[model samples]
Target chain A: MPVALEIVSPEKLLLSRPVDMVVVPAEEGDIGVLPGHAPMIVTLRGGFASLYEGGKVTTKLFIAGGFAEITPERCTVLADEAHPAAELSKAEGQRRLAAAEQAWEAVDKMDVAARDAALAALQVARAMVDAAEAP
Target chain B: MPSLKALRIRINSVRSTQKITSAMKMVAASKLRRAQVQAEAARPYAERMERMLSELAASVAGNKAAPRLLVGTGKEDTHLIVAVTADRGLCGAFNSNVGRAVRTLVQKLEREGRKVKIFCLGRKGRDFLRRDFADRIVGDVSFAGKRRIGFADAEEIAVRITSMLNEGGFDVCTLVFNRFQSVMSQVTTEAQLIPAPPPEAAAAPEAGSAMRAMYEFEPDEETILARLLPRNLAIQIYSALLESAAGEQGARMTAMDSATRNAGDMINRLTLNYNRTRQANITKELIEIISGAEAV
Candidate 1:
């Protein structure tokens, strides 16, 4: 039995299909979902979610921070922002990394929330560059 | 009576106006279709998000540690109203309806001794409300140059609102915009935004089979809710913007269509009068020539 995997962005539903396997970047770590996986809802960090078919990764998407709910039969990913590997640009990723680094430095340390946000953005920026450069 | 030349010119002018209005009508119609399609495309994500949220919120409601976005600060003294309108006009009462509704709401809130601050999403709305409640206007944003609005724009606004919430600017927040009902009708809707309203018992499918499934939380519910609430805010703003965009295009289409039809009718009447005047003038000329010849 295949698990129904859905990836949704704020703008639109990016993907919804039955796949053999789905790997999501959960806040704790990467969670690979297969049929009969226990039901769970996890916060997603900024990374790629790879959908596998016939033992091969068919689609890889760069998802920004959001949440994902996994059930035995279905996995739903609600993302703040999602872009396909094809859409991710190394140049833009490099620029975002530099900007995120500067922002991480400039964020007020007194504001813990701001510092955390800056750190999350920096991690996401780094991930974007890695994903774009990955073969 | 106006001369035949004047009547002809009047008919020509009305005809030209008709042409322009009809063209505008067609343009608006196509634009409305595009907006509607965009709204449709965005519906699935919103529905899924709302469904998951309603379920989670049902469990979390009344909890002491609920996030502020889920359970707002227990004060109603200060109100922040977000009025969404179209940047451009000529959309009949689309802009004015929201404006008037906001004005009435502000007056009522003031009478109740609640301080109200308005955040306008369009220029037309800002202009409309600036007349009486100018002091209440806190901020205004307009997408005049952008041909299309994206989720990023809505997120930007959501971030600002979040910061404002953090600053404890207002105890309550309400969003006022025209809800797209159909091409012929747009309902002026006021929805509470700050404290996500509890899902109506009958309206929400909380009693459904899916809600009963025992789903475990990875990082616990509180942390996920904290993250989810902000994204939900952005999604709400996005959908509201999409609805207003579709409504604006619909209003423009309807207004332009009527103007086109009216211009056509005017041209028709003008042409009839011009032809009648031309025929009468010809009859007079022929009668004078015959009478002169007869006298000679």
Candidate 2:
């Protein structure tokens, strides 16, 4: 039996379909799931999540951060931010990377909490740049 | 017995006012459509967030280590009331209704010896409440010039409230806004924010049974909840803002429609009076002419 995979962002649902396999960027590491996986909830880090069907990659999305809820029959990713990997332009990614780097340099003036937020944003920006450059 | 010219001028002024009101009604109608679409689109994500959070919260329901956001500060002496209304005021009683609801809540809480703070979201509400509750007003946020409401605006307000919560400024938080029912009707609603209300039991049994059967937590439930509770607050605020925006537009449309009709009625009455006065003047002039001819 195929598992239903759904990728939902706060703005909208980006993807929902029955797929053979799904790979998520869990906080611990990238984890792959097949049909009938045990139910679990895990935090996501900034990275790309790929969906597989018919033993081939069907879709890839750049997820900023979010949570994943896994059920026996469904895998739902509630993302803070998400976009199709293919739609991310290299130029735009580079621009964001430069901005993140600039912000990181100036993070010293901010309070510890603000600095941490900036650091997280920088990490997400880096992941987005990498996703945009990947084939 | 006003002069014919004065009555004619009044009728013309009313006709122009009618035109303006009708135009405003059309504008509000278009705005309402967009607002309604955004509100509807936002529901799915907000509802899903609530559902998922409730499931996670169910696990840590009675845990000693649950986040302060869920379990609260263990006191209910202080209250923060977030009142949402429209920035502009041509919307009939929309702003007043929300303001009145908040006022009533504030009075009741104060009567119970509970401290209350008012966080006014829109200018109209702030102005309305200032006359009575000026000392209790803490924050006055206005989107006076914005073309439309956005999630970022809501997020900013949420962040402010969260910071206050962290500072132990308030023990309880409540949101008062108008819920969009239809173009002609809106229901004022008050929802508890801090110490987020547990998911309704009516909605829990089936999902709870399924979730309990198979769910493992990573990095423990406490950490996930610590991050999620704050986010849940933001999401709830965002949804409330969307509903308020839609309700404001709907109320404006209905108000303007009625205003246009009322103007039409006034114009008709003024025109009738002007015609009657003119006829009377013309009859008097003819009678005087005949009387003068007979005297000659």
Winning model by lDDT:
1
Model 1 clashing residue pairs (backbone): none
Docking class of 2: medium
True contacts kept of each: 0.76, 0.52
**Which candidate should be chosen as best, given TM-score against the real structure?**
1
- In DockQ, how does model 1 score against the reference complex? 0.79
Q: In model 2, which residue pairs have backbone atoms overlapping below 3 Å?
A: none
lDDT for position B236 in model 1: 88
Q: Give the per-residue lDDT of model 2 (tens digit) for B222-260.
A: 767866776688788888887888899899989999999
Model 2, chain B: what is the TM-score? 0.97
List, for all models, the DockQ compared with the true complex. 0.79, 0.60
| Model 1 / residue A110 / CA error / Å | 2.3
Interface RMSD of 1: 1.0
